[model samples]
Target: MSSPGFKADAAAMTRAVQGFEECAANAKKTMSDLENDLVSALSHYQGSQATAFWQLHTQLQDKMRVASSELDTMSNLVNQSFHNYGSGDSTVAQSLTSLSNNVDAGGAVFGRLTGA
Candidate 1:
C-alpha cells in the first residue's frame, strides 16, 4: 500500500519548488531594476569616466540578462516537474505501482509453495 503521507510529501515538495521559482523571479526583477537605475546613472556623465563606466555597466548588464534567462528556464522546468508530481501519474508513481504488483505476485507464489 502506498503511504498516506506520499501525497503530503509531494505537495510539500511542489510548494518548495514554487518557492524557488518565486525567489528567482524576485531576484530577476530586482536585477532588472538595478540595471535600469545604472543605465539612468550612465546617461548623466561625461568624458573618459563615462566611457569606462558604460563599459563596466554593459558587461554587468549582459551577465544579468543571462542570469535572468537561466532563472526563467529553471521556472519552466520546475513547473513541468511539479505538474507531473500532482497528477499521481508520474514515472515515480508508475514505478511504485509496478513494485507493489511484483511484491504481491511474489507473496502469492510463496504462499502456494508453503501450502497456505
Candidate 2:
C-alpha cells in the first residue's frame, strides 16, 4: 500500500481543542446550576431514608467539585499544549515559562480548586 499523502491540520486541531475547553467550562456552570436545583429539591424530602440519602449526596459534593475542577484544569492545560505544538514554534523560551506556569497550575488544581 502506498503511504497516505495527508497531514493533520494543526490550526484546526487547536481551534477544536480550544472550543472544547470553552464548552467544558460552560458545561461545568450548567452542571452547578442543576446540582443546586437538585439540592434545593432534596431539602423538601420528608422521610428519614430520604434525608439520609440527601446527606450522603451532600457529603459527595466536595468530591464532585474536585472532579469538575480537575476536568476544567486538564482541559485548559491540553488546550495550551495543543496551541504550543500546533504553532510549531519552539524557539520562544519566554513563552515556555508561561506554558510551564499553566502546567503547574493544572497540577495544583488537582489537589484543590482555585479562583479562575
Candidate 3:
C-alpha cells in the first residue's frame, strides 16, 4: 500500500529517467549525423582536389578528434558528478563546474576549426 506522496514521487522519478534517456539518444543521433556528413564530404573530393582535401580533412579530423575526446571526458565527468550527487558528495558541484569550463574550451576550439 503506497501513500499518495509516494506515488507522486515515483512518477517524478520516471519522468526524470525518461528525459535523461531522450537526451542521451538525441546526443547519439547528432554525433552519428556529424560523422556521416564528414564522410560524405570526403567522398565527394577526388583526384587533385583530393590532395588539398586530404590536408584540410586531416587537420579538421585532428581537431574534431581532440574535441571529441574532450567532450567524452567532460561527459564522464558529468556522469561522475551525478553519481557523486546521488552519494551526497559536495565535490560533485565543483566537478560540474569544471566540466562546464572544459566543454566551453572545447567548443571554442571546435569553433575555430570550423571557422564559425
Candidate 4:
C-alpha cells in the first residue's frame, strides 16, 4: 500500500497535468483565431487593390480612345489641306489654312486630355 504522503503527491501531479492540458488547448484556439483574422485582412486588401487597379485601367482606356480620335481628325484635316494645295485653288488654300488651325487647336486639347 502507498504511504499517505505519496498518494497526495500523485494527486498533485495529476492536477498539474490537467492544468497544463487546459492551457495548451486555450493557446491552440488563440493561434487558430489569429490565423483566420490574418487571412481575412489579406483578402480584403487584395479585393481593394483589384478594384483600384481596374478603375485606373478603365480611365486610362477612355483617355486613350479620346486621344486616338483626336489624332485621326487631325490627320484627316492635314491630308485634306495637302490635296487642296495641290489643286491650285485660292479658296481651297484659305480653307486649308483654317483646317490647319483647327488641327493645332485639337492637338492642344488632346494634349490636355492625355495629361501630357
Candidate 2 stretches with Cα past 4 Å from truth are 1-8, 90-116
Ranking by lDDT: 1, 2, 3, 4
Best by TM-score: 1
Candidate 4 regions exceeding 4 Å error are 47-116
In the range 10-105, model 4's lDDT, one tens digit per residue, is 566556555655655565566556555654544555577867755655665566556556655655665565554434445555788999988788
Q: Distance (Å) between predicted and true CA of 26, model 1? A: 0.7
Candidate 3: regions farther than 4 A off: 1-32, 89-116
Q: What is the lDDT, from 0 to 100, of the residue 77 in candidate 1? A: 88
What lDDT would each prediction earn against the true structure?
0.84, 0.71, 0.67, 0.61
RMSD, one per candidate, in order: 3.7, 18.1, 21.1, 39.5
Model 1 spans > 4 angstroms off: 87-116
Provide backbone clash counts, one per model: 0, 0, 0, 0
Residue 114 CA displacement from its true place in model 4, Å: 99
| 1-116 per-residue lDDT for model 1 (tens digits) | 44668777787877889799789978988998998899899989889989999999989988998998898898888888787666654666789889988878899787888898
Model 3 lDDT per residue over 1-116, tens place:
44566557656655665566566656666766876787788788889897787787677667767766666676666566555444442355568889998878899787888899
Clashes of 1: 0
Error of model 1, residue 88, in angstroms: 5.4
- Lowest-sum lDDT 10-residue window in model 4: 81-90
